[model samples]
Target: MFTHVDAIAGQLGRGLLLTLAMTALAFTGAVAVGLVVAVLRICPVAPLRAFGAGYVTVFRNIPLLVLLVLFVFGLPDLGLLYPLFATVSTAMALYWAAFVCEVVRSGVRAVPRGQAEAARALGLGFGQCLRHVILPQAVRPMVQPLGSIFIGCALSTSLAAAVGVAELTGQAEFLTLRYDQPLTSFALTTVVYVALTLTSGLVAGRVERKVAVVR
Candidate 1:
């Protein structure tokens, strides 16, 4: 029973690598996309703001599983044949990007209006004001909330298994079927997920504390 774990140890390692790869790539992409959405949502232009708001509302409402399926199948029909890994990572990034935009929006809002006014009074344009004065302060308050978002993004990678990315959960399923030890296989999968999540939370917590402002 327990020996089945040893039989597929190499597969387990590869599965973990895939899961981590998805999480890392997706989170990085989400942050970049989400930051742009946040800026668009808050910018002075009405149309841009509307576009940003609509994007967040639509993507946030869609199910992750649906996005994964769409990326894998729908994109191919549209003449774009993204690989399984690319499709899954892009889907997860888009899904998480909506939420990350909201988190970042709140952070941007936390900045004092006076800062932007000061920057503008100094003859700086809107972009300069945001870059030099507003964003520096806004980013400070966003540490904790964004940490939670990061953990959520990390766990969301599990859904990639549905599209055959063969991440951690997928490996367990394959192993269980091959070895006929459902309980042992899945039990280990649960532990691995828990460990990954806990480690992520810890790292985020440390980084948050490091950047936290006392005032």
Candidate 2:
């Protein structure tokens, strides 16, 4: 049934590469932004904490499609025109960062209060305490949540197709129309997506088993 996929393997492969690139780049940015937001959420500074909470509350509630539209069209009039890849990556990254931040904040909260206090007993400042003691312990539990968030981030890149990014779903749709074979084209696409998600879960399992602390 899925016959056209073989003829378009090169095109699909290119699309897959673009999808992976967008996902990897966006996830990298998400990790950085999420870490900062997470740290700010738990920091001693009240204003920073409020800002972090506001950021999460806003971004997490907004539809990712709206964010993609904003990056693609809204920013251009604001004199912040980016190339298509950059536009999609930024939108996807920022959209997912809110969720990632919350995941990390939960991990931080899972850490015992005594850990921070003991670091303070060593004359460490709040940042140093987080760096040397609390976060180190907190990060172990974070691996699973972070992995899931990133998987969602990868899947979310499909939204970028509306802005002409030519990611996996976009290519599948295009091929479907071109070959007049929606069943075959999309079936293969579904298989690829399932494989990717399964691989992500397996990797997350390995990481969780290896480094997860039972607390």
The candidate that achieves the highest TM-score relative to the unseen native structure: 2
**CA lDDT for candidate 2:** 0.86
List candidate 2 segments past 4 Å from native: 1-6
Count of residue pairs whose backbone atoms collide, per candidate = 0, 0
In the range 1-215, model 1's lDDT, one tens digit per residue, is: 56755668887888889988998999899999999999999899999999999999999998999888888989999999868898899888888999889988888788777878888988999889888777777776777777777778877888878888789889988998898988988888778878888887788778776766555
Per-residue C-alpha lDDT of model 2 across residues 1-215, encoded as one tens digit per residue: 35744668977788889988998999999989999999999999999999999999999998999888877989998998779899889888888889989988888888998888888998999899989888778877898888888788878888888878888888988887898889877887778877887898898888878876666
Per-candidate local distance difference test: 0.85, 0.86
Worst 10 residues of 1 by lDDT: 1-10
